[model samples]
Target chain A: MRIVVVAGGVGGARFVRGVREEVQRHRPGSTVDVIVNTGDDWWLAGLRIAPDFDSMLYTLSGQNDEERGWGRVGETERVSAELHAYGVAPEWFTLGDLDLGTHIARSAWQRAGATPSDVARRLQERWPLGVTLHPATDEEVDTHVQLAGDSAGEVRELHFQEWWTRYRAALPAARFVQHGIERAVPSPGVLDALLDCDTILIAPSNPVVSIGTVLAVPGMVEALTAEAAPIVGVSPIIGGSSVRGMAEACLSAIGVQTDAAAVARHYGLRRDGGLLDGWLVGLEDATAVDALESEGFAARAVPLWMRDLDTSAALAAEALDLALALRP
Target chain B: MRIVVVAGGVGGARFVRGVREEVQRHRPGSTVDVIVNTGDDWWLAGLRIAPDFDSMLYTLSGQNDEERGWGRVGETERVSAELHAYGVAPEWFTLGDLDLGTHIARSAWQRAGATPSDVARRLQERWPLGVTLHPATDEEVDTHVQLAGDSAGEVRELHFQEWWTRYRAALPAARFVQHGIERAVPSPGVLDALLDCDTILIAPSNPVVSIGTVLAVPGMVEALTAEAAPIVGVSPIIGGSSVRGMAEACLSAIGVQTDAAAVARHYGLRRDGGLLDGWLVGLEDATAVDALESEGFAARAVPLWMRDLDTSAALAAEALDLALALRP
Candidate 1:
């Protein structure tokens, strides 16, 4: 199966990591392609640090710090503190010592006139991925969250990490803006992977922000809509709450209800103008099954908890099966 | 007296750390000016890393790691592991976590088009050195050391750290090349600081590279010679041994003797016919005073063992006294 999986940082890397484990057990020909979000890239100190891309890289390599859900396991803060001594510090960020190296390499490559796509390819070359890994866009397209009033009056754009890590996403989110998406082209093979793939699985990632930002990039939504090949999305929000992060906060900001039916409805059905060929909700939200079917979209209810690799693989397999069944 | 120090990392930084303490004990208006060598500056992983300049800054700020002698205290190495995970490693050289922050800030400033001098100013703005700090040259001129035949082997120029840290300077040194020094201009205010100085100190830094690289800059030797201010140098070598690193390997490479007297004679009364009015040799090498004098340089013996801050200051003061006394 030529399966393309689009993912964000923590949750996305985790789900995709599980996908790799499942595929390893199957025949060697089932290739897994990962399209990671680059909306969380930031310049810390002098390094062009790509948080999401690195999280995905670490996850796939089995080097990720499980406790932090990001960064390397045995990370240290020596260099960060040394940077503080030089007085260029945003000391609150938990940038593991090991994490800085990826930023360093990526930044160096970019400075030397290499594109994000070029940098990503070199990194993936080491893994060969059994599948290919790709950044969603070559140019930076950060997803900034606008939060309700404090001193800035109505809203201010917060870097995704600021919204997620610093505020823990408790601050009322307004809407997520994928800044520079208009200028960003997909990382070389991204569009091809999505359009030419046998199946495209949008994992249980944030709908209004994470997945929404990926779809927001100028022509990306058009490409997915044009693809007759099955495109399946698993609801990140189970009943009405986010699996992680402030998806509910992001959903409310965009005026979309946070329930599974609302999520499938947000993607909408084929005839009514949306991207979902099929949608899957967790078994707890079996009621959304009827609503999705009535709206003329193929929908199913399954267990969505990523408690272990086996469970995540089952979720992926179910999503892939739906895509293969939808195949014309 | 307003004192200015010309330095690189390690030996030079250690000297200036002592100089900073000496200058503080003097009456008000007595300031120290530090001119750090930027030839060693490199853009690693996109951060503008000035190893020597920062060591001085941290030492002066009273936050240098006494154990490492470079980098900051309470530093961590989590970033290095992250770099390894990405397979983007020059693992041969260590980039402490806190140390990476300094590089990040400098890299950002430079990327935004700030010169090394400007970044240094920004770094020292909050620190109380009461002295002006400037990089010798704002250009990118890395020092490359060519070793004769060894494990890494022939015709290759090792980056300074690879030569120093990795090989431990064990290979026969062929020649030291300061790449790009010919095309460089002294950072703004550098020559002026040298020409307007009361006394010029050639800190007992590794002569073949560190301090030598600074002196090799096109107009630098001319500026020092043109100034009648006593050009006094403290010996980095005592007896036939180096105070640090492999000065002997370097001295042997140039066919120059490795004793205190030879180091004094190598810097001699000049670079291309210029010479110091005074040279300070360690007490253990008191016998070399006559030989240094035979080379047409007035030399003095002082206890150069920098066991503690006070002694280092005393040694610095003694050297300053000899320079002042040697004035015409």
Candidate 2:
């Protein structure tokens, strides 16, 4: 069996871990491929940093900080402090010494003329990550957020990291823009994974800047609407709130309501010319399932809180089952 | 008074510290400039590294690890370990986390169109290094050592760092080659420092790679021969061997004996189209003083072992006194 997952960062990493666990236990010999959003990537101190890819890599390789919920375990920021001392900018987004190793290698490879896909392959070779990780696109399509209003009348736009990390998303965003998206093509193996997979699952990542950015790639929507596989999405929102991160602020930026049913409707039903064939809401939002089905989504309410590996694996199992049921 | 010093890495750093101390105590209000050898610098993991400049920076700022003889006092190697794990080349040359900060900042600034001099100025701004440091040349003239012979009939040459760090200079070198020296000009302020200084002193650094490479710059020898200032050199050798590092191997590679008299003759007398008007040797090599004098050098034998700050300062003061005595 082959499964393809669309993902972003922390939440996405955790969800994909669950997917890997579920597949390893029940569907032995199955291959799982992840199409990770690279919109959060940017150049800092001349290093190419792909936050989403690093999050997924660290989490899958079991090197991630479980307690802090991000970055590598036993990490140090000595390099970052030195950079600050040298007056390098973007002081808010601290890079741990271990994380910097990855960034340095990526930047070196990129500068040596390797594409983003080539770098991903080289990085993944360092560990047995169980699942293949492919960038959403090889082109640099860093997401920049336009500020809604500024009383100072200056500095109205910021890279997604500056907006998210430096400002903590407090500055209302007018819209999220993916620079270079027009010239981007799906990374090697992304389309193959989607077209040849038995099922497709959207991990519970940020709907606006994460999964939304992935969909916004010129050929992405066309590939999804081609009916290659049954697509099911797990709601990042449960009981009208996000479980982690600032997905609510992100959804609000794109004028999407912070509700399970609203998110499902945002992705919409494939029969109605949208992306998903199935949608999974949390048990707390079980009441929204009937309305979602009435609106043409083969929707189900499941326990969606991925508190531990077991709970996460169970949630992943429920989503896979829902997608399989919707398969023609 | 304006003083200029030609220097290399560890030994040069120690010598400069003494020069700084000597000037502060005796020649009050005197300005000291150091022409640091950039021949040892090379790209590692896509970072522009200048060892001599960093040594001067750390030592002058009191951030050097005195016990270890190099790098920042409190240093970590987490990033280096990660690079090793990723199979990045030249693993023998490990970079401490703190040291990497300087390299990253320098590489970024250089990428942003800053010249080597500009990078050096910006880096020195972080710490009040008592002396101004300038690269020998602004161009990337990294020294490569051509191996004497290879049994495999391959790999005839290696970067200086690879030979020094990886092989520990055990591989006999045929000759030293500076890749971009023909097109190189002295770095900004280098020729000015040489031409306008009241007196010039050569630190007891590696004569072949450090002082030799500096002199190899197209305009450097011409500037030295212009006779604007009296030039004095302190022999890097004592008795029949180098006081520190592998200067002996480098001397042998260039067919020069590792002796104070031999080294003085190598620099020769400025009257005969050479660089030095005076030469300082260790008290142990006092017997060679008369021979040096007969060969047109104002020779002096002093306690040249820089075992501590006081001794180093005394040696620096002796060299300055000798140069002043020969001021014509």
Candidate 3:
């Protein structure tokens, strides 16, 4: 069986780890393809830093700092400190030494004209990461956020990282914009993964920006809608709050409420002009299941909190069960 | 008195430290300008690394690793090891973490369209270097060495660093070519430093590359010759050998013997269409003084071993005395 998972950084990485674990245990030989969001990629100090791709890569390679939930384990920030001291890079977005190793390697390849997908392939080749990772698109599709009420009382556009990392999503976000999404097409293998997979899982990543940005790539939405595979989305929101990250802030920016029912409706049923065939929410949000099912989704609520690999794998197994049950 | 010095790395840095100390003591409140050789500069991993310029900067700023005689005092090679693992950069040319900070800063400024001299000015402002530093030229004048034989027996051309660092100058070099020196012009303040200074000192650096490349700049030779200040050169060679570095290999490449008299003749006398008005050699080579004087150069021999700061300063003082005696 082939499983394709859409992922962002932290939440997505954790969820994908469970998916990989589930595939390894139950399916035994299933191939898992991960289409990672690259909208958060940015050039810092002339190095191309793909936060989502690297986060997933490090996590899968067992090199990620679990305590930090991002970056490499046992990493030092000596180089980043130097960069800050030189006043060349933002002090807030610090890159650890081990993390810089990845960026430096990727930037070297990029400068040599390798596409993002090509660079990702090279990186994965170095590790025994059983899963295949593909960027959502090879094109530069950076997410920018417009915020309201600066000191000037005027809207200002910031790189999504600045909004997310620096501001901690505190400033009222007017809207989110994928700067180059119009010209972006799914990276090579992305459409193939979606079309050929037995199941497609939208990870518990930020709905409006992470998964939303992946779907924003030209032809991606059409490919998913046309694919025969059942599309299952795990709700990032649970009990009127984000399971992780600032999904509420992102949801509110798009005038959507921070609830499982609202999020399931946001990605509605594929038969009703939306992306999901089934939706998974937290047990606490089980009350919203009937409303989602009434709207044509094979909706269910499970213990969605991924406290460990065992719990996360159980969540992945449930999502796969839902996808199979919804299959035509 | 405004003192100007032409320098490279290691030896030049040591010499310049003494020059700085000498200026502070004897010519209090006087300024020292350093015209550093950039021919040793190269692009490694897309960052501009000016070896000579950085050596002087690190040495003067008191950040240089005294034991290693290069790089930062407390340097780490984590990033470099990563680059090597990624097969992105030459493993032979290792860049330490703290040293990379300077390169990152300089590369950022260069990419932002700031000239090399402008970057140096900015760096000096951060530290009380007490001396101004300028690249000999802003142009990329990388020195390339042509070797007589390889396994293929065809003359192979290599970047000066490749020969100097990787091979430790073991290969028999046919000649040295400053790649872009033909069209190179002195950086801003270079000509002014030479023309306006009370005396010009040629630090005991490799003559054929460090000082040779500087003179190879289109009009640099003319500027020094026309300047009223006496041009005094301290010999890198002592007791029939180079005091440090691969000056012997470089001298042999240019068909000059490794001796004080032969080197003085290589630079020749100012009246005889060459660079120096006076030559300073070690006391061990005092016999060569009369020969240099007969060739129309005001020559003197003094203690040239830079055993300590005091010894180096005394040598600097002796070079200045020779230059003063040669004044018209």
Candidate 4:
């Protein structure tokens, strides 16, 4: 079986790890392609920092700090500290020393005129990672959050990182705008992977920014709904809260309640002009499954907390089973 | 009093330290402006690494590693090791963590349309570094060494770092080419500093690459000759050998023997359209002083080995005194 997962950074990284394990266990020869959100990618200190892409890369390569769930293991912030000493502000999000190696390499390749996808392929060549990673788009489509409470009449657009990391998403987001999304085409293999895969899984990432930004790429929605494969979306919002990250705040920005069923409804059935054939919610949110199923969707409840690799794999396996069962 | 010094990396840095100390002790309120060689600058992993400029910056700011004689006092190579793990080659010259911070800041400023001079000024503003640092040119003018023995029948050009660091200057250089030097204009304040200074001291740096590259700037030689202040050069070569760095090998590339008198003759008499009005040779090389004097240069013998700050200051005071005595 071939699987394609749409993913963000931390939570998506954990979810994809489970999916990779399930594929290795059940379909021994299957391939997995991850289409990662590049909306969080930005140029900081002349380095192209792709937070989501690096998180996936480090997690898959077994080099991610499991405790922090972000950045590389055995990382140092000497360079970051030095940058701070030089009075570079926005010091909230730190780039670790070991992580800088990847950014330095990627930035060099990107500045050399190679597309983001091309650089990703080159990076993946370093490790025997079981899955292929493709950026959502080669072009810059950064997610800018327009703050609702800006006293000035003019809108204040904050880079997704500033809003999410520095401010912890406390300031209400008036609107989430994926800058340059209209001009962004899906990276070379994104559309092909989504269409050709036997099953498509939307990892438990931010619905409004991660998956939403990916779908917003010009032809992405059309390609997903047109594909013959069944699409399963694992809810990031579970039991009236986010399992990881600030998905609750992101959902609130769009006037959606922090519940699995609400998120599933947000990504409605593909038959009803949306991108999901099935939805996977936490067992605690089991009641949400019945409500989703009533609206032409195949929904299921599972133990969604990825406490360990085994538990994560189990959740992924359940999601895959739902997709397979709903397949025409 | 205003002083201008032409400098390179390590040796130049040490000499500049002596000058700074001398100014602090004797002149009290004198200012020193350094026109540092940018020929050693190169792009590594997309970072703009300026070895000479950084060497001078660190030395004057009292942040230089006294034991290592280069880079920051406390530096970690975690990022560099990570880069090697990612298969980056030519890992000869390591960029330490703390050092990367400066490069990161400077590269960002340069990309944001600031000149190298502007970046230097901003960097100086962070530390109460009494001296001002200026690049020889704002534009790229990397020194490329043409190897004498390339099997391709054509001279192979290499970056100065590759020739100096990787090979340790073992390969006989057929010629030295300052790539992009022709189109290069002196960085802002370079010519003005040279022309307006009360004394112009040629630091004990490599004459061929360090001081030579500075003089190669289009109007630089004219400015130094036209300036009324006596241009005094302290010999990097003492007792028929280099005091520091690979001055002997660099001199051989330009067909000059490593001797105090020969170097003075190479710079020649300012009356005969050359740079120096006086030459400071080591006490061990006092025999060459008379020969230099015969060529119309006001030559003097001094204890040139900068063993400590006190000794370095004494040497700097002697050089300054020589310039003062030779002034018209």
Candidate 5:
């Protein structure tokens, strides 16, 4: 089986780590292709930081902070403090000293003629991670949040971090925009993998902001829907709350309820029409099955929590089984 | 009185420190404007560093590394170690952690719409230095040396530090090229200060690479010639050696002898009827005076050894008096 997973950041990274293990074991001939979201890319301190791409890369490479699940471990804060003293400080994101090493390496490598996926693969070489990961597109499409402040009718574009960090999601967002997506074409391998895959899985990740942004790339959604295989999407919303962070703010921005059924509904049961062929809701949200099947889609209730390697592997298996059955 | 001083890097930075005191005390109404050589500019870790400009800025601010006469004090080396581990080990020139802060700030500010002059003024505001400083140009003009080595026929560009530190000027050069100077315009206040100045005091800095590069700016030499004030140059070469670094190697690159008279002669008695009106030599080079008058320049033999503040200030006084006497 050739499995293509549309992934965001941490949750996607963790899920992919487990998926790679399963393919090597039970599904020995399976090839894993990760379509990574690039919505969180931003240029900081004259160096570009592709947060989502790096998170997935670092996690797969085993260099990611196991405790925090983001950023590299053994990070130092001296550079951040010095930057602060100079008053170029962005109060929200603290750039650790050791973390800057990776960024510096990436920026220089990119300048030396390497693409994002190429650089990620080179970074992955340190761990010898044998999997194909591709940025959805090579172009720069930044995700910006338009927010309405104290004065009504006043709207300004906030860089994603400001919406997610400084405001802590309190600002009333007029809309979320993946700016420049209109010009963004999928990377070379993207459309073919989406169209020719045995199964396509959407990792339980931010929908409106991340996976949504990736799908917004022109022709990607159309290509995925044209595939004959089952298209399964794992729910990021579990047990009436986010399985991780900030997905609720994003869901709310799109006016979706923060629940498994609403997540499935937001994606919408599209067995014969759109991208998703099968939708996996949390086992705790079993009540969602009747409504999901009513919309004429393949729906299953499974353990969606990915607390450890085994649990995550089991979750991947559940989603794959659902995808296979739906196609079968 | 308005005084224009032509300068290079740290050695010139020291002389400039003394010039600041002289301009403020003796020529109270006079403003000191320095034409700093930008031939040493290079991009390090994605940030532009103008070593000579930075040295002048730090020295004038009273924040100079007195012992090292370069980077910031109380500096750390964490980033250098990190960079080394990344195979970016430019072992020759060490970038101290605290010193990196200035580079970061300037880069960030410049990227955020501040011009080089605007950034300099902002930096100077904190220090309230007595004089004005300007990079030779807003454009980047780097000095590239053609060396005769095993890698002969390979014209690799070395950031000024690499030549001064990594190779320690050990590489023999065919010639020095001021790359990008053709595209450059003199930085704000450079030509005007030279034209309107009461006197022009050329610091005893690297002539070929430093003062020569400044004079290479379009119409700068013409502006000096047009000014009624005499142009006085202090020799960087002293007692058959450079007062500090690379002056001998730099002179050899231009095929000039490493002696005070040779340096003055290299600038030319009239710079082919262009540059200096008077030349100041050290007390030891007093015998070279007869040749100087014949060359149509009133040469002065002063105690030009700047071992400390007192020695540097006395040297500055003698050069100014010569400049005053030679004024048309």
Candidate 6:
């Protein structure tokens, strides 16, 4: 079986881990291809930092910090501290010394003319990740957020990282803009993964920036609608709140309600010329299933809290089951 | 009083510290400008690795590992280890985490169109390094060493760092070639420091790749000979051997004997259209003093071992006194 997953950073990494676990246990020999959003990537101290890609790499390789919920375990910030001392900007986003190895290697490879896909392949070679990670696009389409309510109509644009990591998403965002998105084509292998896969799953990542950015790629929507592969999405929102991260702020920026049914409607139904064939909402939001089904989605209420590996695996199984059921 | 010193890496850094100490104690309010060699610099993983400049910075700021004879005092190699694990080339040369900060900052600034001189000024701002440091040349003049004998005449050239750090200077070098020396001009303030100073002292650095590369800059020799600031050089060779590092290997590569008088002759006398007006040899090389004098250089033999700050300061004073006596 071949499966394609669209993902963001931390939440996406966790969800992918669950997907991998479920595939390994039940669907042996299944291949999982992850299409990671690169919208959060930015240049720091001249290094190319792909937060989502690194999260996927670290988490899948079992090198990720479980306690801190991000970055590599046993990581040191010596270099980051020194960068801060040197007065390098964006002091808020601190990269670990171990993690910097990834950025440095990636930057070096990129500088040597390797595309994002090439770098991803090289990075993945370092570990037996079991899944292939593809950058959503080779083009630089970093998400920049425009803050709301600027006096005198003055515009304030901040990189998604600055708005998210630095400000913790406290600042009200008017809109999220992925620079160069209009011209971005799906990275190498992305189209093949989507069209050739048996099922396509959207991980519970940020709807506004993560999965949204991937879908926003010029040819992505066309390719998705072109395929008969069952498209299933797990809700990042549960019981009117995000399962992880500040997806609420991101959704609110685009005026989407922080509710499972609303998020399902946001992705909409394939029959209605939108994305999902099936939508999995949390058990806490079981009441929204009828409304979602009424709106033409193959909606199901399941235990969505991925607190540990088993739980994540179970949630992933539920999503896969829903995808299979929705399959024509 | 304004003084200029031409220097290299570790040896030069130590010598400059002494010069700074001596000037502070004896000639209060005096300014010392150091023209640092950039020949040893190379791009590592896209970061500009300026060994000599960093040595001066770390040493002057008291952050250098004195016992290990290089890098930051409490350095970690997490990033470097990662780089190695990632299979980045030149695994022999490892940069410490704290040290990488400087390189990253420098690479960023250079990428943003800041020259070496501008970066130097900004780096100096971090620490109260009393002496002002200037790169020998604004242009890239990385020294490449050609191995003495290549089988089948397949000429092999390695970057100076690879030769010095990786091979430990054991690979017999045929000649040292500065890649862009032909068109290279001194970096900003290098000529001014040479021409406008009251005295000029050549640090007991590597004569071939360090001080030699500085002199190799197109207008450097002209500026040195054009000035009457009494150019005095302290010999890096003592007792028919180099005081530190592998200066003997370098000197032999260029067909210069590893002897104090030979090195003095190599620099030649300012009267004979060479650089030095005065030459300071170690007390062990006292026998060469008379020959040096006969060769048109005012020669002196003094205790030259910089074992401690006091001894280094004393040596600096001796070099200063020699320069002043040779003044026109």
Q: Judged by lDDT, which candidate is best? A: 6
Candidate 6 chain B, poorest ten consecutive residues by summed lDDT: B188-197
- lDDT at position B48, candidate 4: 87
Candidate 2 lDDT, B148-263, residue by residue in tens:
87575654999999998898888899899998799999987787777667888999999998889888889887776675677889989998889898988899999999999899
B1-328 per-residue lDDT for model 4 (tens digits): 8998888988888888899999988898899998899989988878888999998889888889999888999888888887777665358988898998898888878888888998888888888678888998898888999998757688888999999999989889988898767898888788878766799999988999999988888878887777799899999998999988788889998999999888988987888888889899999988887878887889899999999888888988998998889777
Q: What tens-digit string does per-residue lDDT give for candidate 2 at A1-328?
A: 7888999999999999999999889988989999999999999999999999999999999999999999999998999999999987567998999999999999998999999988999999998799999999999999999998757565478899999999888989988998779998887679877776788899999998899999988898777667567999999999999988898889998899999989988987787789988899999999998988888888888999999999989998998898788777
Lowest lDDT sum, 10 consecutive residues, model 4 chain B, at B82-91
Stretches > 4 Å off in candidate 5: A21-30, A67-69, A77-89, A102-115, A118-128, A148-154, A192-196, A293-297, A324-327, B22-30, B44-46, B77-115, B122-127, B148-166, B270-274, B325-328
Task: Determine which window of 10 residues in candidate 2 chain B has minimal summed lDDT.
Answer: B148-157
Chain A TM-score, cand. 2: 0.97
What is candidate 4's fraction of native contacts? Answer: 0.74
- Interface root-mean-square deviation, each candidate: 2.9, 0.5, 1.3, 1.3, 2.3, 0.6
lDDT of 1 by residue, B1-328 (tens): 7666667667776677677667778635666677777656665565667877887777777778888677778776666655765655577667767666677777777877898888888888867666677888887888888878665544877777677767888867788888777898877768767756777787887787778778778777776678767878888888778888777877888888888887777776753486567788888988878877776788888998877788888878887787788776
Ranking by lDDT: 6, 2, 3, 4, 5, 1
Interface DockQ of candidate 6? 0.88
Q: Which ten residues in a row have the lowest lDDT in candidate 6 chain A?
A: A188-197
How many Å off is the CA of A70 in candidate 4? 1.5
Alpha carbon lDDT at A314, candidate 5 = 90
Docking verdict class for candidate 4: medium
Q: Residue by residue across A1-328, what tens digits does model 3's lDDT show?
A: 8889998988998899999999889989999999999989998887789999999999988999999778888999898888887778897797888788788789878888999989998898888698999999999989999987657767789999998899899988998898767889999879878776788999999988889899899998887777788999998887888978888889999999998888878877788788889999899998989988887888898999999999999999999999888777
Model 2 misplacement above 4 A: A150-155, B150-155
Of 2 and 5, the candidate ranking higher by lDDT: 2
Q: Give per-residue CA lDDT, model 5, range A218-286, as digits (tens).
A: 988877777787889998988899888788878887899999888777776565456677888888888
Model 6, residue B186: what's the lDDT? Answer: 87
Q: Give me the displacement of residue A237 in model 2, in angstroms.
A: 0.6
Report the alpha-carbon TM-score of model 5 versus the true structure. 0.88
